[model samples]
Target: MSETRPAPLAGLKVIEISAFVAAPLGAMTLAQLGADVIRIDPIGGNIDANRWPISDDGTSIYWASLNKGKRSVTLDLKSEEGQKIATDLIAEAGTLVTNLPARGWLSYENLSQHREDLVMLRLNGSHDGKPAVDYTINAASGFPIITGDDERPVNNAIPAWDVAAGLYISNGIIAAELERRSSGKGQEITLALSDVMLATVGNLGYIAEVQATGKTRGPLGNGLYGAYGQSFATSDGREIMVAVISNKHWRGLGKA
Candidate 1:
């Protein structure tokens, strides 16, 4: 006999109307945790459907990787009928996760009027009502400047802000669900990519140090910040990166 395991979000349902990284990744996280996630894309698919990192056969590996374990539906959000259908689905699911702007038919005020206990999680680029993306946010948050070597600023290979913001949005959804259980009212949660990166920079004490001492942190190539760490080449021509952050670790590395 096989053992049966229950998922944490088995009974939860989420209607995800989003494209690109952050919102889709957040919905995918919820789906992986056993939420019934219904992803509504545009008629011919959203912007990410044909995004890069594709296979030779034109399949978008990037999109597939992020959109796993979710049911998909296509609709023309611009049309009145399509809008009604989306609204119906949203009302039925009682939860929506989207990275689109909070306006038009998808606005919290418009949706909440239909279902009072509707939980809507909106992901945006900036909190100041300005448009932004992962790369822009990364640059604006001062990460790119301190990422690479001392030569010049380099953008990161990974969309760090997008991934982090996605996880944060997922966490927000879970917390909102818990709150709704007791309050019997759904709430709107808004997350911005820029805010997430800024918060991360602040949490790491980078922003505080700059504010207090008026000093800018420079980039350290392959070295850990405030620690004894660097990459070294072995005698056999092999490379290894090591970090000795504590006294015990330093002693252990020395002994080795």
Candidate 2:
């Protein structure tokens, strides 16, 4: 598969200053496609470091899986000297990624100052004044209420909002790079978990419009809605979803 890769980012360097799944995963994808990815770790490691699945050699497989093809360098950005190192790295780097909020990371602003041509991907919980984590984003966007059994609605089993925001951030970085090739200027990309969930729920934006007009949309059971969709139990006792939109197919299925 390596032989087939075109490696669009062969000479580009990316500095990833992020913890946990989302931001790291984005940087890793760029690295796999041939970008030189450098992970910036805090002196004592980030909070999410070594939280699970330790190998015999004490290496965290969870971390390795997400950060496989990247180099790591530790620095204490809180100190003046450490901040200088991070700023220098960013000035040399073509792209930078971070999940930490701008307010929390003082060096982020400084790096931008030093490298005006640096493309940045900043991921955070919320774009608004509020914090935008997985659970809070899900609830506010009505994603939880639309999920799970009717007895009690729940959030998704996975951290989908975070992942989505990261992917969006990655794409934004690439797009910004493309624009820079034409215009010769860098860009800052921002993504929030809540905005990502809201965009996902936008598939049912019409429903939201109706609800706002004094109509309520709730609990669609395991039956067809408006004679088009149905959720049936499979032979293995699992639910299989089928959607029939055309009248011809509906009639052929004996749904008269």
Candidate 3:
């Protein structure tokens, strides 16, 4: 095992009103750093307790992994008493992380009334009002076009976009916390899945440069765009990734 580092959020208090992978991972990250996190679930329960890969007794190991080291409470947020409890909890909480639909539910307006300084993170599927998922998001961001062979485009097999957004949200939350320390005021941060996907594409600037000139990028099967890179299957059925650093290396490999 690696050496343990000091917990950065030793005295912070957070309340998580979220389910699913993105926001829960963010909340768990904070808790791992020694923050006090209370996970508020619906009275009927937010997580689907009957999903796959259960224990011998039928407990959801997936939920347990994401929810380790946190306190949980069941509440009915639609009820008058439940809303009151949430409001009070927000007033006392140093941070709030949630992924629920923001408009009809507890809007920033309603929550700000309770405590203007409460730090909030609202995660969404789209920047506007359109609902989206990982595949659709990857498609919109130009990742899928250059994903597969020329014959067909393929969506990424992993939920890379969602995981990226979760990490970015966690970092943004801590940045907001630092800003709060200096300014004595908290903030509200919004991260959308669509926006995150777009940002991921932006990291590869060559793609944008090509698109700007009325030309589009394409999938270079088993090779780099203008250079040499290969993703190949070995005789043992294992995958190997190799990239050429220079013309010399390319020529040497070609000869070999």
Candidate 4:
């Protein structure tokens, strides 16, 4: 039998101060994988406390799902004592994940004073720090133009950018943790929501395509980009997605 090993993030302590999808989800991901995560909120709860998908008694399943596996505390962050508690927690945890405005007590500069090697990962809406969210970021990603069957631009309902940013946040924290372990130093990591979308569009060659061809790709609804994929409806009123990513797969599809 193979030897057993502890979780990659086991024994890691993290503090998360956030309200919505990206930061909370990132922290939750870490918590699920064995990091000890403590989420700090206002006296009652954060703004996403009553977010959609509520249960009959009025509980936010959306928020709960994103924050599962993480311990939570509510404090009056506006008060000096409350700020002190939060700062002390951050200093002890040594890692902070947040998407809130990082001014005031939550600022990296302020927290780093408590622990010289604190790893603070802050998320911003835009590169210049203007406010933005998943819907707004997705609107600028150029995906909507190729999302539907026509060029009218249909935005997907899914918060793809937010999900991507959440994963990126998790990765950022891990990388920072590793760096801190090696160098005995910690640094501030800033991730812009818009930059996630921009990076995705660039990685997918959409920006280069526009530059090289001077035109946007035509709409291809429910189809792969630069590949063979389609959604098919069966006579039994069911739908299935099919794709051929290789020569063997294409031959198998032709045979079928």
Tens-place lDDT digits, model 3, residues 1-256 = 9998868998888888887677888888889888888989898678654455679998888788878999998889988899789778877886888888765446777787788887889898898856777778887777677876785887788878877887877888889889998998988898988888777777867557877887777876677776778898999999998889898997888897
lDDT of 4 by residue, 162-191 (tens): 899999999999999999999999999999
Q: Identify the candidate with maximal TM-score.
A: 1
User: Lowest summed lDDT over 10 consecutive residues: which window, candidate 2?
Assistant: 102-111
At residue 93, candidate 4 shows an lDDT of 93
Where does model 3 exceed 4 Å of error?
A: 1-6, 47-49, 53-57, 246-256
TM-score comparison, 1 vs 4, better candidate: 1
Model 1 residue 133 CA deviation (Å) reads 1.0
Superposition TM-score, candidate 2 onto the true structure: 0.80
- Global local distance difference test of model 2: 0.77
Q: What is the lDDT of residue 122 in candidate 3?
A: 89
The best candidate in terms of lDDT: 4
Alpha-carbon lDDT, every model: 0.90, 0.77, 0.81, 0.91
- Collision count for each candidate, in order: 0, 1, 0, 0
Superposed Cα deviation of residue 238, candidate 1 (Å): 3.4
Query: On residues 1-256, what C-alpha lDDT tens digit does candidate 1 reach at each position?
Result: 9988989999899999888899899999999999999999998888889898899999999999999999999999999999899999999988999988779899999999888999999987888868798999988877777776786998888999999998998899999999998899999998888889989989999889999999887887788888887899999999999998899998898899
RMSD of each: 1.5, 3.7, 3.4, 1.6
Residue pairs with colliding backbones in model 2 are 125-132
